[model samples]
Target: MRKIVTVADDADLAHLVDLIDMLPGPDTRSFWGEGSNSIGSKVGHRLREILSGRGDSSDVDYLAIYVLKYLGRGNRHIPEDRITANLRGASGLPAAGHAWVEDATRTAFTLVTRYSLPVWNGAHRTRGSAWLQG
Candidate 1:
């Protein structure tokens, strides 16, 4: 496999190079290009790698493919959430007006009640537990 280089500006790149130079091994890396969608999970993982101080961009190609697949996942080019809100409401899920609106309202209420007693504490804690279980 070819080497990889992080995409960064002068100051960040200088620091990166210096850090790499200090590592026990001598290595070089290359970059094919920018972020893409074909590699969504891979890109996410690489992002975690970068954030955690690992140096690798083999995921760039996968990212490019991922971006090409879902060009608007990063941007609301089609205002999909608005459209989804309508569709979800129409789905007849017994929502408070609709699923989207219901979720929005519920989420809003949750925030609004941030100053309230811990009555919702169990529910919120359950949500966290579910996340961990998942």
Candidate 2:
């Protein structure tokens, strides 16, 4: 997963929740807890509860990463990316190969970039932090 600087406000977070709600949750039985039965839908709902005039910036930042991990599964239904899997665990084979997954990924990325700060890549530091300078 790419490092992101989350600048999402309540409205942006609300929109993101809407997008997330459209996805089907993971199909694994163990993923469900005592009260919650759906992973994807529960994530969105929980985010909504937090963002509904109650959450702080830290909550938003945390949830932004949470939503990204939830959206980052590959065509194989798992994160495929080692770092992502290590951090968020394998995403099981439920939403894999779905066209909506691509749409959700793009929307999530667009939301993130809309307010993200420019990151200075370590390997490219020789060029100086021109983006920050600007």
| Each model's lDDT | 0.34, 0.47
How many pairs collide in each candidate, listed in order? 14, 0
Candidate with best lDDT? 2
lDDT of predicted model 2: 0.47
Q: What's the CA RMSD for each of the models?
A: 19.8, 9.8
Residue pairs with backbone overlap in model 2: none
TM-score of every candidate: 0.26, 0.43
Report the C-alpha lDDT of model 1 over 44-103, residue by residue, as the tens digit: 554455445454443333333332232223333322243243332244333422333333
Candidate 2 segments exceeding 4 Å error? 1-11, 24-49, 73-97, 114-134
RMSD of 1: 19.8
